[model samples]
Target chain A: MKTPWNRFDFLLLPLLGGAFILLLWHLSSHSWSGDLPDPAKTWHESKPYVLEPWAKRGELDQGILRFTFLSLILVAKGYAIALILGTPIGFFLGLSPTFNKAFDPIIQILRPVSPLAWLPLGMVLFAKIKGINVTEVAALFTIALCSMWPTVLNTAVGVRAIPTDYLNVARVLKLSRWKTLTKVMIPATLPYMFTGFRLSLGIAWLVIVAAEMLTGRPGVGGFLWQQYNALVYEQIILCILTIGGVGFILDRLMSVIERRFKTI
Target chain B: MSAHLELFNLTKVYPSKKGPQTIVRDFNLQIPKGEFVSIIGHSGCGKSTVLMMVAGLTTVTSGGIILAGRELSGPGPDRGIVFQSPSLLPWMTARENVMLGINQVFFTATEQERAQIAEYYLSVVGLADFMDKRPAELSQGMRQRVGIARAFALKPKMLLLDEPFGMLDSLTRYELQQVLIDLWRRNQITTVMVTHDVDEALYLSDRVVCMTDGPEAGIGEILNVPLPRPRDRKAILELPEYHRLRATLIEFLEVRAHHRPNSSNSPSGAATPPASVPVSA
Candidate 1:
C-alpha cells in the first residue's frame, strides 16, 4: 500500500491539510457561494476582532475574546455542575447493578436527545431569574442538562471497567467504603472521567452557541447570531475561527489537568 | 506450632447453566502464625480460589476461615493480598500507591510518619529510587515490587500472594521471590501464596500444600520444608531433600493433576482420581 504521508512528515502534513482547506474555502467563495467573502476579504474585515480582542460597547455587542470569555464562563458553570453531579451518579450506576438497571434506560433515552431540545425545558425550569435575564438562566440550565450525559455515561463505564484485582486489593486491605471510593474508585476511573469531561466540555461549548443565540448574551454564539442577522458574513468567519481556537485550547488544558492528576 | 489461620471444610462452587460446578470441595488447611505457606497445583485447580477465600476477596460458599482466634468474615487490612498482576492505580505513583494503604491503616499516624512508612517499605522492595514513578512508568517487575511494598506497608496479620510474579520472566520471578522471602523473614506474617512453580513453593514456604486438579480440587498432600531459614537458591538446589520435594511436586502436577476434567465437559474424567493421566515430567 502507498501512503500520501511520509513516516516523518507529521507537522508538515497537517499544515498542508490546513492550506488545502483554505484553498477550498477561497475557491468556493469565488464560485458557488459568491455572497460569502473570500479568505483574504474576510481576513481584512475581521482584523479588528484580532487587534482588540476584548472590547465592549453595548449589551449585545463585544469583541471576540470578551465574547469567548462569556462563553467559557457559561460552559465552565455547566461543566462544573456536570462533573459534580454526574460523577457520583456514574459511580452509583457502575457500583450498583440495581441502580444501573433503574437508570440506564432513562439515561440512554435522554443521552441522545438533541441538546437544543433541552433549551425550552431549561426555559420552563428557570423561568423566573432574580437578577439575571430569564433566557440567560435558562441557557445555563440547558448547558448543564446537555453536557452532563457524557460524563455520567463515561464515569459509569470507567467504574465498571476497573480491574477486579484493584477491587480485591481494596477489599483485602479492609479499606473503609469512603477510602475505597477516594483511593481505588476515583483514581482508577479518572482517565475515563477525563474522557467524559472533554466530551462534556465539547457538548457544553456546542450548546452555549445555540443557547446564546436564543438568549442574547454578548458571547461568541450571540455574536455569531448577530452577524447572521446583520448579514455580516465576514465577522461570522471571525466567530468561527475564535470558537475553534478556544475549543482547542480548552481540550489542551484538560489534557494538562489529566497529566497533573496522573502524577498524584 | 499452634494454628494462627484455620480453614475448616472450605469449599467454593460457581453456578453454571448445567449445575453448580464445584471448584474446591471440602478443602482444609491450618497455618501457624508467621508461617509462609504455598498452595501448588496445575492451573484452574482452584488454588487461587483457596487463597482468595482466605483473603476474603472471594465469598466462601460454605464453611469458615478462622484467623487468630477470630472467625474471618470479610476482607480487612489484617490480610494483605497481592494478585497475579499488581493492579496499582495508573494515576498514582509507586509511593502514592503504597501510601494509599498507609493513610488508611495508619490514620492516626503523623503525616511525616506515614511518608516514612511508605519510603521504608518501598526501599524494602528495592524501589527506593523509583518510588516517584507511576505504575505506567515502571516495568512489570518494578510494578510488582510496588505491589509488594503496598501490601507489606499495611503491617497486615496475614499476607496473601496469588502468583505475585506469575507475569514476570524467569529471571524477574526469581529475584522477586527472593525479595518476597526476605520480606516474609522480617515480619514472618502468616502468608498464603498460590503458585505453579515447584521451586518457588519449596524456596519460600515453610509448608507446601499440593492441590489436586479442580472441579472439586482439595488438598492432595502437604509437604513440610525442612530447609533452613534465610534460604539461598543455589544452596537449596544442592540439598538432596530439596530436589526430592521438587520432583514430588512436579510429579503430582504432571500425573495426578491431568485426571481433572478438561473444558469439554467430562465430569467422569475428574470423578475418577487415580485414573489414567498420560502426562508426566
Candidate 2:
C-alpha cells in the first residue's frame, strides 16, 4: 500500500518550495528596484563574509562565526541556569498542591511579561552585584528569566500528569521517597521536561539575540543592529540567514537528544 | 485455619458537596491462607473500593484491615497489587518493570540474583521473549502479563487484582485467566480479585463473594465453588454445578437491576434492594 509520496518525494517537496520562494524573491527585487538589495547584489557583497566566517577583524568587526559562537555561549549560559533552577522548583510545585496554589498566580503574572521589560530592572539590579559587567549580566539575566517559564510550567505539568497508577505502584512497593522520585517521577516526567527544555532553548536563543542587540554586545543580534545602523542591507540579510540556520540546527539537536532519552 | 486476611466491618465514606457519602458499609470478609477469592458485582458496586481498602491504598473510614497478625496501616511490599490498566512504566523494558519491585523487596539479593528472579517470573508469564520490549511495543495482554510478573516477583503475602483483564478482548482474557490460574496454583498465594464477570470468578476463584450495588454497598453472598481441583474450562462447563452457579448469580443481579430506582444510578444514591435473599448454595 505505498502512496504516491515516497521518502524522495518528501525531501524534494520542501526543497522545491524553498527554491520557488527564492525565485520569487529574485524576480520581485528586480521588478520593484527600490531600497531592497537585489539577491545577486547581496550575494556578491556578502560572499567574502560567508567564505571567511571565522576571520577576526576587530571586536565590532568580528567574523560571522565569532558572532554566532558568542550568541551560542550566552544561550548556553542562560539555558543552563534555567535548567538548574527551574527543574526542582517545577517538581516542588507539581508535588505540592499548596505550593502550586500559592505560586501559580505569580508565575502567571510574570510569564507573559516581555523579555525586553526586564532589561532596565536587570541592569539596575546587576550593576552593583559583583564581578561581571553590568550590561552583560543584565543581558544574561533577562535571557535566563524569560526562558525559565516554559521549563518550569512544562515540568510541573509533566510531573502532575504522571499516571496515578504509577504512583500506586510506588506505594505498593513501599519504595523510599528518593527511589520513587528517581524511578517513577523523573522517568515519567522526562518527556514533558524535555518538551519544556526544547521550548526554553528556543526562547533562550530568541531572547539572547534581542538582549544582545539592545545591550550593544558582541553577538549575532548586535552584528545585525550594527549593520542596520551602517545601512548594509547585505550583511543584515546574511545575519538573518545565519541566525535562522543555527536555530534550526539547535532544534534538531534537541530532538536527537529527546529521541535518545525516549528510547531508554 | 485462622484467617490470613480479614476486613472487619470496613467502611469508606467520600465527602461530597452535599455531605459524606458511604460507598462500602459494614463490609466483612475473611480469607484463609492460600485461598483464591473473587469479589463480583455490578458496576459501581464498590467491590474495587473494598479491594483498595484491603490493599491499604484507600482510607478506611470506620474499620480496619488485618493481614496475618498485624493491623494494616498503608500500602506495603507485603501486599502486591495489579491494577486494571497494566500500569507498567512505559519507559522501561518489561524486564526492568518487573525488576523494579524485585529490587525494592529483595534489596539484599545480589544484582544477578535479582535479575534472575525477574527473569523467572517473566518466563512464568510467557513473556521471556518480550522481556526487553517496552509496554507500547507489546499488546495489552503482554503488558498485563508484565504487571502480573512484577507483582509475583515481589513474592508478597497477598496478591490483589482489580479486574486485571477487564480491558482485554474475550480470547485474550481467557488466555490470561489460564495463565493467572496456573501461576496461582503453583505458588498458592492468597489472592483477592475484583471483577464483574461471573464465569471468570467461577473459573479462577475458590470462593466468589458477591456484593450489592452502591451507595452503601455490602457483601450480598459468598458462594463456595465446589468444582474439583485442576479444573479445565471445557470440563468445568460440562458440570451440572457450573450451570446452577451461573444461573443463580445472574438471577440475583437481574433482580437487583430491575428493582434499582432510576435515581440509584446517581453517584451518591443509596442502593436499596427490594428484598434480601438468603444464599442457596
lDDT of 2 at A158: 90
* Interface RMS deviation of candidate 2: 2.1
User: Across all candidates, what is each one's fraction of true contacts kept?
Assistant: 0.82, 0.82
DockQ of 2: 0.65
Q: Considering every candidate listed, which one attains the maximal TM-score?
A: 2
> What are the lDDT scores of the predictions, listed in order?
0.85, 0.87
Question: Tens digit of lDDT per residue, candidate 1, span A163-218?
Answer: 88788777766787888888788888888888888888888888888888887777
TM-score of candidate 1 against the unseen true structure: 0.86
Docking class of 2: medium
Worst 10 residues of 1 chain B by lDDT: B261-270
- The parts of candidate 1 lying over 4 Å away from their true place are A1-31, A47-50, A128-132, A259-264, B106-119, B228-230, B259-281
Per-residue lDDT tens digits for candidate 1, residues B61-137, read 99999999999987888888888888887778899889888988999999999999999999989998999998888
User: lDDT score of model 1?
Assistant: 0.85
Task: Residues A1-264, candidate 2: write the lDDT tens digits.
Answer: 577667578799899998998888788777885666877888998887778888778786877888899999988988899999899989999999999999999999999888789988999997887778889888888988999988999899999999998899898888899999999999989988998898899889889778988899988999889889998888888888889999999999998887777753
